[model samples]
Target: MVCDMSSDIFSRQLDFSKFDLIYAGAQKNMGPAGTTLVVVKEDVLGKVSRKIPSMMDYKVHISKGSMFNTPPVFAVYTSMLTMQWLKDLGGIKAIEEENDKKARLIYSEIDLNPLFKGYAVKEDRSNMNATFTLENENLKETFDAMWKEAGINGLNGHRSVGGYRASMYNALSLDSVKVLVEVMSDLESKA
Candidate 1:
């Protein structure tokens, strides 16, 4: 039940023993969007006596080696490539540091900017998706216009949660975060 919602997994300070399962979408920190990851203790598996359908059952998938009806072919292939890329880039430890640095810059900018405010509680806020909004509602139009002008795309927030969300996934570098901070700073000066 304990989810480390942070982007940089290495920055997680959670006590993993407390959780029954650990789940993460590969798209965010690991790989592309199509693949999902679940790691559960072997002892925790057979306790659910409910008759779960084949595809819906983790035990079945685990038994079948995840080749439950051919599986997501392209997603698995891409995921393999991403894992190799991670290995080549010095693995999880190195990537975690880079991700942390990127998140810090973006969060720092959002925190310091008078006009902008982050969405989540400080501790619960995701380092991957830095969700925030302009305090002056009138500035929404202006901010959208500015990001468009700067050739920045996908900074828009999810409709479920109004405002802006800069998703700095693993592939997104510190340089990209710096560029985004510069944009925020520029906008703040104008405001």
Candidate 2:
């Protein structure tokens, strides 16, 4: 009964047999925004006590071959291209390894750096989004400037959670992760 929509999707593996319904917003690990890829065990629809709106119902979308309305063409096409690229790279199995390496590199710094603290519990840390915060809030402005100067962007955390979030998606390379780590380490040295 867990409706998990945490946005990892393609970046992390999940057992579909364990989930009656799983939804992923394409903007995260997939393509652009305005599209959501959903997988559901159809039987679960039968148990819904309330009526679902046509636009929001999975059954409708499935029945129409996902053409229930004017879909986001750009997002859908880009998502398809992303999937093809991933497949060519030996699919999820291969990308998962690269992702693990990137996560390890950054998390190692987050752990070793005295000026920073990881936001997620060590065991529950996400491979896609490694979140961490400053040990000294006073250093926020300085750290922000430092990372930006290092050519890092989109390093901000989710609006609901204020800190920093390093997104290690499928296409992000080990070298990119290294640059971020270097910036973090630089921050530590300067602190």
Candidate 3:
């Protein structure tokens, strides 16, 4: 199976042998945009019977060491530096621990704060995304202003979900999560 791993790339590690290919963009948890990461098993190549265009073919890119065309030099370098940063801090396992801590903090506030309700069930919760909505939608205006005044930005939910989303990516600090929880608690006080 070919998996688009952009969302979960630096948060955790996966078994590479199970997939024919995995592709990701280095923006969510790694670097700035303009770079794509592709991981494919060598055996999967040359098995396709159809014509594969040069630019679209992974084999061609592989043969060129991913430098076949104009590469996004800065994005690639930033990704490498971030990967090195993660490694120096103990790699995927370490980041997973951090992500879990952040997730737990936010989810606990979501559960404890009666005014807010989580978008997903406990077992279905994501370690990187804490999606929730205010039980009292009337407080949206006040709560929005509260978080913004607290120096938080991009806490809006996915456009389709239409509530609130806290993206605790790998680079996000645990203290940031604490700040968010504090904001939520403050909202509860005002309610």
TM-score, ranked from best to worst: 3, 2, 1
The models' CA-based lDDT, in order, is: 0.77, 0.85, 0.92
lDDT digits (tens) for residues 137-178 of candidate 1: 987888888877777899888999988889877788788788
Each candidate's root-mean-square deviation in Å?
A: 2.6, 1.7, 1.2
What's the TM-score of each model vs. the native?
0.86, 0.91, 0.95
Candidate 1, poorest ten consecutive residues by summed lDDT: 4-13
Give Cα distance to truth, residue 109, candidate 1, Å: 1.1
Of 1 and 3, which scores higher on lDDT? 3
By lDDT, the better pick of 2 and 3 is 3
With candidate 1 superimposed using the best TM-score fit, by how many Å does residue 40's alpha carbon deviate from the native? 2.2
